[model samples]
Target: MLDNYEDILTVNDLADMLKIGKNTAYQLINTGQIKSVKLGRIHRIPRQNVIDYIIEKSR
Candidate 1:
């Protein structure tokens, strides 16, 4: 589904992909709804995590 995105995705990228705001993307990460790795001040989300989130939400 997210073939255009790389294996690792940035919060902004995720936001754009989901058509949501950056705050909402951050909320998803902070709430642990979408798994991510925090590196210093930056967050890296795996492409699979987003796919999983979509699939989970569909269920």
Candidate 2:
């Protein structure tokens, strides 16, 4: 279930969860589709944000 994921997720984690490529994960963040926070040069995505993206796409 989505709730099983960590609160803060890395790009790789996002990719695994969504079954998407790493570039596609970056694209989602770059396109403002999935909200993320910057930690140095890394993007940390929230589980809720991913859930939101899922709901948005499902619509």
Candidate 3:
């Protein structure tokens, strides 16, 4: 779906897609296991960064 190809994803969406908890997702972001961009007061995770992280960690 086109919607699934978004440039950025919310924390909730990340958890749903990765089958993880919000806390775990936050941990990943905070620990730099995943990349994120903070805009205003919101944190947005870029899709490409998540993909890259997955690939890097899978090795």
Taking all chains together, each candidate's TM-score versus the true structure is: 0.96, 0.93, 0.85
| Cα RMSD (angstroms) for every candidate in the order listed | 0.7, 0.8, 2.2
How many clashes would you count in candidate 2? 0
Q: lDDT rank, highest first?
A: 1, 2, 3
lDDT per residue as tens, model 3, 1-59? 32575788988878877889999998998899898997887779988888888789899
Q: lDDT of each prediction vs. the true structure?
A: 0.97, 0.93, 0.84
- Put down candidate 1 lDDT per residue, 1-59, tens digits, no spaces: 58988999999999998999999999999999999999999999999999999999999
lDDT of 2 by residue, 11-54 (tens): 99999999999999999999999999999999999899999999
Model 1 alpha-carbon miss at residue 30, Å = 0.2
- Write the candidate numbers in order of decreasing TM-score: 1, 2, 3
Predicted structure 3, TM vs. truth: 0.85
In terms of TM-score, which candidate is stronger, 1 or 2?
1
State the lDDT at 56 in candidate 1. 99
Which residue pairs in candidate 2 have backbone atoms (N, alpha carbon, C) closer than 3 angstroms, thus clashing? none
When 1 and 3 are scored with lDDT, the better candidate is: 1
